[model samples]
Structures are given as C-alpha cells and as structure tokens.
Target: MAETVQAATLRADVAIIGAGPAGLFAAFECGMLRLGTVLIDALDETGGQCAALYPEKPIYDIPAHPAIEAGALVAALEQQIAPFAVPRLLGRRIERLQGSRGAFSLGTDHGDSIHARAVIIAAGAGAFGPNRPPLPGLAAYEQTGSVQYYVRRKEAFHGKRLVIAGGGDSAIDWALELREIALHITLIHRRAKFRAAPERLAQLEAASGPGGPIELVVPYQLHALHGDGGTLASVEVATLEGDRRRIEADHLLAFFGLSTDLGPVSQWGLQSALHHIQVAPSTCETSLPGVFAIGDVATYPGKLKLILQGFSEGAMAAHAIHPIVHPHTALHFEYSTSKGAPGSRDAPGSLAGAGHAPRPAAA
Candidate 1:
C-alpha cells in the first residue's frame, strides 16, 4: 500500500529504506548535503518500531537531552527534516535491489519503482514481530485485546489490572510506565534477575511493595491463562517446583522480545550472516556497491547496537556517498555550525531574512 505521490516512478539522489531512527537521521544528513532523499518503509507511518511498539518508552542515551520519550524523539527528527520535505513512500517494502554505484534501481512491494544514485539500508531488525508466549486460548484473548504484545495506546490499559510477563526492558519499562494508570500491576518473571538498565530497574524496585502500585513475582513462569470467552480473568504462574499461583488481571502483556526476519533484504544479493548484513565499518557500505547498511541490521567488528552509533554511521555513509553522487565535484567538509541548514535564520538568503516563507525542496 504505497501512498499516492506525484509520480509513479520516483527519482532521488538517495533512497533510504526503513524510516527508523537511523533512516530518518540519514534523510536529514542527506538534506544538509543538499541531496534529494526519499524515505520508504513497510510501516504505514514513519518512526518504525519506536512509533509502532513503545512510543512512550524513554531513551536516556540520546545526546543533548538527558531523557526523551521514543515518540518525542521521532517527532523531533520529523521536525528537523521538515524543511527538506523528503518524500515518504509508506506502507511499502523495497523488494528488489539492482544496478551499481551512482545508478541504482529499487522495486517496492506495491508496484513502485525508485531510481536513485545511492541506497541506504538503515532497517532495524528488518521485518520484526513479537515473540508471543505459548498459552492455551491465547488467540481468543489476543483477538479481544485482552492479551497484547505491543502497547500502541496507554489509555487502553488505564484503570485495568495488568499482568506483565518477561524479564527484559520492554516488560520492566511498561510495568513502570503503566503502574500509574493500571489499577493493579504484577510483573512475573522466571528469574529474579532482570535484564534492563540499572536506573529503570531501580525505578521499578522503588515503586514495588507488598501492596503498592506494582508487585514483583519472581522465579515464576507463566503456566496458563484463565479466562472466559475472550475476557481475561486471571493469569496462572508456577515455579520450578510446580507450585502455582493465580494473579487476577484483565490484560496480559508478554514481552519476550522480537523474532526478526531479514525477509527480502537477505535476498538482495548482499553478504549477510545470521540475518545481519556485513558492511565495511568506515563507510558502512555493504558487499554490493551503492548499497549501505546501518543500525541493528548491520554488522561489523566492534559494532555497538546503539542509536547514537547509528547516527554517526549515517553521517559517515553520507560523506562517503557524496563522491558517487557528484563525480566531478569535490566535497569540502564543513561543520554544521559553520554551514547553517537551508531555511534556517543563519543560512544565506533565508526566508526569515527575506520576510517570506521558504518553499519545500524538491525530492
């Protein structure tokens, strides 16, 4: 399902795949370099997993701000790229990748062709889905929204009893996030030790008490879901000794992480291992010329799976790609502070100084 754009075949200096944090930043980087970029994603909207999964999740590592919600970060990125007016082909996946450096062709799932000088694959865990727990009558509950994998809306869980099961960040984060909205919150994990940020774990522990906002049920695994029709009544958990306990709840959030598949990306003739594309660390370019991989889907020696690192990689890839896009010209590197972004107050011939609005850059 591709959005109706100005033309059936879109052309650009760079065609970015994924539309996640890295992809969005790549668009901004390309725009700063005065290159036309188009963002394409399989999801209907931008922001990728951050928008789809946990929009309310807080990220502490992003530079500048001490803490920011995932959704807010996406919004800031969108606003940063507003002046460029980068074309977005949403609800579509790039299925085919062909051609070489400086001249590449891409075909999407919805019968759309995109021609670009360079391609950047910033896909984070390409084509991801949640890993659901195996429980009887789970489908019925899921159909009724009694059991959910992703928290798209926080208001839906307001005043409800929630039984969160998992030991990862998603489980703990949501437990802390929904503690205020939920009438009662119980987090059940098979292990007492949880894998999450220390500060977040401390926050969860601080709020947890015998009969406070949240309850911690450790060393207990989900045994079964007891419900009537599609309305969840309670969740049954058991220990290694087979001792079981039932926690009354209206909804169950199982966050076992994601089961990711590279899907069409692996079939794009790029070198890949364990569903991760192999790329050169310096340029982030894949084995296939003109195509680069970044973010979680890209793999290299000493690669850190961090959002900030992906941002750096996007900058590196853009600089590397400058030569390919403008073969005759040389790129004289300049800091963003020295060269203000187009349409900014500091930029030459800015709309602010001209007393008129700036038009959107062509994509």
Candidate 2:
C-alpha cells in the first residue's frame, strides 16, 4: 500500500525524519555526499529532543571535548547542517511513508507527497506518549487541550496559567523549569514520590517557601475537568485521603514519557526488528538497501540513546550511504566528513557533555 502514497512535500536523494542531532547530522552527511536531502520534523525547530524538552540540562559522556548544554549544542549542530542547505519541513507531521529507497513517497499534513529513494527515521522517543500512568480525566484533557504530550516550546504557555501531570523527573523538572514563565502550576501526581535526580529535586524544594512552590498536589488525582467551550478553566482534584479541591489554570502540561509509532511507514515492508527498521549494528543501513536509521530511534547491541550517539550514527549512516550512492568511488575514512565514526573521538564538536554540566565548553 506504500508503493505510491501522495500528499505535498519535496523530492530528494535522502529524507530524514526528526531534526534531532541524528537528523541534523544526516543533513550534514548528505551535503558532504552532494546528495539532495530533505529533513522533516514535528517541531518547528531542529535538535529534536535535545533542543526541545531539556534545553537546560547538561549532557556528558560524548567523548573528548568536555561539556555543553543542549541549547548551545543544538545551535552549533544546526549551523553544521546549514551548509547543506537541505530543504526543511518543520511544524508538520508525516502522516505516512510509502515506497522504498530512491522511489519513496511521503504523506504530509501540508498536502505534499514527496518522492525520494531513501529515508532515515530519526523520530527519537518523543513522537508518542508513555505506557504507564492512567490519569483521571486525561483522555478528555488530551483531546480538549488540558493535557499535552510535548514540552519543547515554552513560549506558547508563557504568562498563562497551567497545570502539570506526573510526579516523575519530567513532571517536576518541567514544572520547576517553566515556573518562571508560567502563571501557575498545580502538580498533580498519584503519589508524593518523584523520580527526578536528587539534586534537581533539591533545587525544586529550595524554591518552595510560602505557598509551597506552585502547590504540589500530592496523593491527588484529577477527578474531572470543568471548562467552557473545551477551554480548561479549572481542574477538579480528589486526594486519596478524601481531600478535594479545584485548581484554576489556563493549560496542562503532561511530561509522561516519549515514544514513536512509526505508523503506516513501518508497513512499507522495510527490514525491521520488532517493527523497527533494522540496520547494521554499527552502520544504520536497513536490510532494504539504501534505507538507514539514526539518532535516538535507531538501536544496536550497545547503542546509547544520546545526542552524542545520534551524531555518530548520522555521520556513520552518511558514510555508509556515500559508497552506495557513488558505487565506483572508494571511501576514505580519514578524509570523509565523518568525524566520530563509532570508535573515533575526532568529530571536532563533541556533544559528550551537551547536557548542562558544572562547566561549559568553548564551541
């Protein structure tokens, strides 16, 4: 069924879904290979999860070059992809994917069916929601706008009243993180226990003084929602100990978890492991010829799901495809655009410490 799906997009030699570190690096690789490439992402900006969810967090373990924050690193990687001048599709969703390498079609909500030979799915885990936590009134709120899955864009809720669901790292983290801009936060969780790093929790605790830091509603569940015209005006809460209250807010932020469905695109009959398109352990080439996977979405025996790892995967996938696209050409590992080729730490810029650390590295 994926042989000839259509909508509105662009033709390209390579198409990368999700503009995280993997997708951005893939664009860089495509530029180096002189292949026309197009990068697509659900969010308006690049850098994927790193750019969106935890821009404030610092990342380490990228190998070599000390540390950097997610925001700065995303900006730098984005610059690297600029030379490619790859056509970009942002603030849009890929409804479906069809066909195969060099002959693929994309179905986008923008009403474009793009044609390409090869595709790389780098959607990370942010495309979908997590499996656990059956919250009260969550389904209605999700459809009505009281519950949100992604937190990449903070400006949207600036100066607006909001309520957040979840007591884990993301919940508390985002709650504490966005408190500066958001009007109000009623953190509703099933229990009092939080799953964030102890240090982060300490910071959150330090901020709570008089009203108790944005009203942490412990042992509480959203009983129901009362809003006018689908707009969330107040959230009804019921505690396990029989306490009840109503929280007035403008919006809801839910930092449950992240996932991806791969949707009908996976049905295009590409080689896959457990439905995920399979690629060589080291390189991201899928069993179906030119197709590849990179970034947080791609998996290998010991693959680490981090921007550092994603950057390496993008570079490797590009290098691997260079030979195939230019069949008669010999690949020179030393001179190729690939810097961090799995075992090497020469990738000029290391996202190793891209997460927020005590010290920031000079880009």
Candidate 3:
C-alpha cells in the first residue's frame, strides 16, 4: 500500500511571495498597517538573488550607504523586520493559487497550503537555476557534494584543493575571496581576459604573483573528470592548442551564471510580459483583484528595475491592500515619524492590541 502525503495549511492576512529585499520590506509595511503577514520563498534563506547568487559582492547603488555587501544588506533587512515575527515558508515553491480577492489559497510543491486575504508576488525574475557545464559525469560528482555552483558558505572550502572554472565575476570574486581559506586555488578560464570588474581582475592578477595561493590556467577548457565512486580526485583540461593537462583537486566550483524561468507563475491568469507580471502603476495590483506584483517580477510603464523602485512599489501595494483586508474600517495614513515605530506604545494600532475583525456598523 502506498502512503498518502498530507498538505500542511496556514492562514494570514497577507501572503508575500519572494523573501528578497522587496518582500522583506513589504512584510514590514504590512505589519505597520496592522495586517497579519507571512512570507514565502523558493530559496531556503531570505535575500533572494542577493543572498544566493552573490552574497559577498558589494552593491554601490543602495541609497545612504556608499557600499554594502549583499549578505550584510540582507542581514540588516532581517533585523529591521524582527518585530513583525513574520512566518516564512522557505525551500518550497508555490505551485498553484485558488480563490480570489478577500480570500485566496496557495498550494506549494511540498504539499503545504496558505490561506490569505491578499497575495503579493515579489518573486524576482521568478525562479533561478544555475547553468551547468557540459562535462560528463558532472552530475555524479555533484551527488557527492564535491562540486559547487554557488558559495553558500566560504568556510566549507577551507583547506581543500579547489579548481574553479569560468571567467565571470562570480568565478573571479570567489577565486580571490577563497584564497585565504582554501589549501590551494587554481582558476581555469577559456580566455586570458576576464569579464569581472577591473579592480577585481587586477586583484586576481596581483594575487597570482609568485608564492600566492592562486594559480591561473588560461585559454583552456575542462576536458574530463578523474574520479571514482562520485568522489573527484582531479580534473583534465585541454588548451586551444590541443595540449591536455591534469590538476589534482578535491573540489570544483563552476560559475556559469543562472538561467531564470517563470515556473508555476506562468500558469497563473495574471497578464505577463517578458516573464514579468503586468501591474498597475497606482496600486501595483495584478489582474487578480487582491493579488499584487512588485520588484523585478513586476512590469509597469516607466518601471525601473532598481531596488529603490521596488521598495516604492511594495509600499504602494501595502496601502492598496489595506481596504480589502479591512473593508469596514477607514485607514488613516500617517508618516512613520508621526506614528512612531511599530509595536511602540505611541504607534497607532500597535501589534499588541491591533485586531483584524471588521468594525461594527454605527448604530
């Protein structure tokens, strides 16, 4: 007899998809409006691409701070929303959505479901997957955990012989960053030139000087993998001149960038363009009455794909959603400075006393 899997269920006033900066900020905004909120993300952790693709990379365009590491920015956002105590459903993909407007049901691939009055699609570029190399038996080695596409934790590479492939920013960045921890690092690129920032390329070049922890093998492509039982012992590469060389390595890090797809979101009835959800500029609302789209996943006239722009969109969607979630009450919008921080005694409708019930009709 086969066992049946049971779907776990949850309830919230607002369900914000994609736990990126935009989604995190949206949760905070909704909390300020006294709305019960929950966040869902495909990745196991928050911060979306900033956390998954390039945690250590520096972002210079964020307002206020001249420069901030991607991981640090995510950490700060996490701290800012600590008071909200928002529930997060991580490592699960939302496969289907049912119901409309005042009530909606979300079904996840893991058999989990959420019931919410309003839904926010903040999913940046939908779902992203790593681009794998063409090397045979790569999957077998990946099964052993000896091959990595992204650096979730730098400590994992400590004292291990690593052979990194690619000439992109991720490849060069990790190569330079991992030098201090890894036993020895060899960077293999198909061309002598790299596509990374000029400063980073210079740093890699300087570090490759005599006695440095890194070695550069340029104008070469990975030819084969030498290993047994899914454990890699070394890798074989061939030069453009047809010369082959082998290097001993315990691990391989390949950075070929990502391939993004709309995934289950494409199946939804919302209007879309170039894989982005079409939204109204005034409300950020999608075709569905109570469903909103923001961030990179949202498309609008004069839409700027900037983080600040996404932040504005989140605020707009939150304000627009207030009436639907609380039809009987008239929301009074006030600046944060006047209302004070959420949860404060001075803050209007603090979480301690805020209620979601509709106000009774006047006698």
TM-score of each: 0.90, 0.70, 0.82
For model 1 the local lDDT of residue 105 reads 83
Q: What tens digits encode model 1's per-residue C-alpha lDDT throughout 1-363?
A: 123353257778888998999999988787777677788888888998999998977888999989998999999998887776677888888888888898898888887788888999998998788898888888999999999999988989999999999999889989998988999999999999999999988898888865679999989999999989999999999999999999999999999999887778888889988778999999999999999888988999999999999999998888888788877768788788777765587653233432212122344
Task: Give the clashing pairs for model 1.
Answer: none
For model 2, the superposed segments whose C-alpha errors exceed 4 Å read: 1-11, 41-75, 89-117, 126-162, 180-184, 208-214, 226-233, 240-242, 248-251, 271-275, 335-363
Indicate the TM-score of model 2.
Answer: 0.70
List, residue by residue over 223-312, the lDDT tens digit for candidate 3: 999999989999899998899999999999998888998788889889988778999999999998999999999998999998889889
Per-residue lDDT of model 2, residues 1-363, tens digit only: 001222344667677788887787777766655555677777777777777666755566556647776777778777765544456777767777766555777777776556666777887753654543455555666676566765646777788888888878778777787788887777888888888889978877776556654778788876767776667888778887778988888787766666557665566566766645557877787767677888665666787766777777887787776665556768665554454432123443232311111111122
Alpha carbon lDDT of each predicted model? 0.85, 0.67, 0.86
Cα-lDDT of candidate 1: 0.85
Better of 2 and 3 by TM-score: 3
User: Largest lDDT belongs to which candidate?
Assistant: 3
Alpha-carbon shift of residue 244 in model 3 (angstroms):
1.9
Task: Tell me, by TM-score, which candidate is best.
Answer: 1
Instruction: Select the stronger candidate by lDDT from 2 and 3.
Output: 3
Relative to the true structure, candidate 1 reaches a TM of: 0.90
